[model samples]
Target: MYAAAGANARACSRRGRSLILPLRPLAWPAVTIRLGHSHEADDVFLFHALTAGKVDTGDLQIEPVVLDFQGLNDKASRGELEATTLSVHAYAYARKHYRLLRSGWTFGEGRGPMIVAREAMTAETLAAASIAVGGVTSSAYLAMTLWNPRARTRVLPFDKVLPAVETGLVDAGLMVHEEEMALELTGLVCVHDLGEWWSGKTDGLPLPLGSVVVRRDVDEDVQRQLHKAVSESVHYALANRQEVVTAVRGTVGGLEADLADDFLGRYITDLSLDIGDRGQSAAEEFLRRGCETGIIPDSLPLEFAPSAAAEPSSSARDGARS
Candidate 1:
C-alpha cells in the first residue's frame, strides 16, 4: 500500500511537470539589425545616442555597418543591409528593396555640393570641362548633370576627388560633405553650388542629400519600433549636443569641436528628426527630375515605414518650410 502511494505520487509529479511547462512564458531572442551609414561626423552624431545605449531600442540590437557614402549606396543597391544611409540619387535604384524612414535625412537649404577647381572658370567652361565626381550615383553627380548636361565626369573615391583636381588630373571635382567646406583651405574656387541652383530651380525647396532606409522585409511592427528609436536618437543627440559632438569628434580626424558643431548644425536639424511634408515633396521632386533627365532608369513611388510617432512636430514642419 505504501509502494502504491509512492507510485501514485510519482505519476502526479510527472503530470504536474507537464502542466507547468505549458504555462511558462516563451522567451524570444533579440533580433540583430544591421544599420549602414557613412563615417562622416554628421552621420556619427546622429547615431551616437542609439549606438551608445542612450535610447531604448527594446528587442532590436543595432549593429552599425560604417562605410563611405558610396559604399553604403552600393550596399543599398544590392539590398545587403537591414537599414542604410543612401544618397538620394542611389535611392532611385534601391527603392524597390527598401522603404525610406521618416527620420535621418540630410537636406541642404541653400548650401550643398559644389564644383571646385584650382582656378576659377566660367559656368560654360566648367560645364564643358572634365569633372571628377565621388560616384556616378552620388546626388552631387546627378545635380551636376542636371545643372549642365554637357559636363563630362569620371568617378573617383570621394577623398581622391580633391587630390585629382589638385594634381591637374581633372579640371574640377564635385565637392560634397566636409570637402565642400574645405575649398578655401585647399585653394580651390567654387564653380557652382548645386544646392543654390537646385533651390532656385525648385522654388526654394531644400536639396535632399542623404536619407536612411529600412528593408521592406522587416516586420512592420519592428519597422515602426526602429523608426521611433531613430527619432529618439536624433532627439537625444540634439538635446545633448555638446556631449554628442565631443564623443564623435575623434571619428573624423582633425575635427575640432567648433567645426563638428557647425557641420552637425547644417545637416542634423528638425528634418533629421522627422522629415516633414516639404522634405517629402523635395525628395519626390528630386527623383522625378532624375527620371525626366534619363539619368535614373525609372523612379519608384516613395514609401515610408508606418509610424504614428514619425509625423513631424509643428516646429519641425515650420523649420522645414523655413
Candidate 2:
C-alpha cells in the first residue's frame, strides 16, 4: 500500500482502509539567479555553501557561471550577468550597470599583486621595462600603472602571466590570484608588492582587490534577496571553513590543501564577509586614485547593496578567524 501511494504521497490508515495523503510541498519554485565568479580557490570557498546546497537560499536557485576574473569583469562591463565578481578597477567602468555587494569582497591588508621578474630589479627599472599583466581592466593593472604610469604592459591571461615571464616574453609579470604563491617555485623574484605599496600610500588602509556586484536593473526585492543569500552563504562557508577548504581543493585543480588554506587565510577575512567601513573607504580611495592617475576614465560614488539585517552567528564569528 505504501509503495502504491508513490513518493509524493504518504500512506495512512483510516477506518481500517488504506488512505493516501499528499505530502507537504517541499519547496516553492526557485528563481534562477546567474552568479558569475572566478574559478579561483577564494571564490570557490566563498560560494561553496550556496553552490553545494549547504545553506538555504530561500527561493533562489543560484547558477554559477564560472569564468576567469577578466571574463567576469568583461561581462560586468556589459551588464551581462545578474551578479558577478569584478576587479575594483573594472568596477570603475561597470558601476553604471551594477552596484557593489557588501559581502564577497577581497582585500589585501598588507599584501597583494606583485611584479615578478627573473632577476631583482629596482622599481625605476621595472617601470620602464615591458611587463605582462593579467588584464588591463584588473585592479592589479591599475595599481601597477599608479605605481609607475610609464610601465609598458601587455595583456595576458592571469594563468599565463607567470609562463610569459618565465619564457622572457616580458621583463616581468604583474601577478595576481594564486600565481603569487608559485613565485619561489618558478624561480622568480618579486620586484614590487603592489598591495604593500598601496597600503603604505594609503596610510595602512586595505587594498581593495575584487568584489561582487549585482545588476542595477535587478528588482530591489530581488537585490535584497541576493544580498541576504550571499551574506548567508559567506557566513555558512565561514562557519564550516575546513569543509569548504576541502571541497574547494577538490574542485579547483592543482589547488593543494596547504595552498587553499593559505589563500583563504589571506583573502577570506571579515572583510570578505562584509566590506565594512574601512573596506569601503579603501575601495573609494583606490578608485579615486585610479581616476586621478588617468588609468580609470571616470569616478563615481561607490554604491552598495542593502545588507541583511541579521548579524552573523557566534559560529560564523568564530570561524572567521584565520
The models' CA-based lDDT, in order, is 0.83, 0.82
Q: Candidate 1: what lDDT?
A: 0.83
lDDT tens digits, residue span 1-322, model 2: 1233446566788889988665553333556789998888878888888888877776667999999888898899899998988899999889899999999888887899888999999757876889998789888888888888888888876678889999999999988855665676899999899999998999999888889999887755567778887888889888888888888878887766786788788877998888889999999899888898877877568988766555544353234321
Show where candidate 1 strays beyond 4 Å.
1-25, 309-322
Count of clashes in candidate 1 = 0
- Give a tens-digit lDDT track for model 1, residues 29-95: 5667999988788788889898989999976889999998889999999999999888999998898
Candidate 2: lDDT of 78?
A: 95
**Superposition TM-score, candidate 2 onto the true structure:** 0.86
Pairs that clash in candidate 2: none
Q: Cα RMSD (Å) between model 1 and the true structure?
A: 8.6
Which model scores highest in lDDT? 1
lDDT of 2 at 313: 43
Worst 10 residues of 1 by lDDT: 1-10
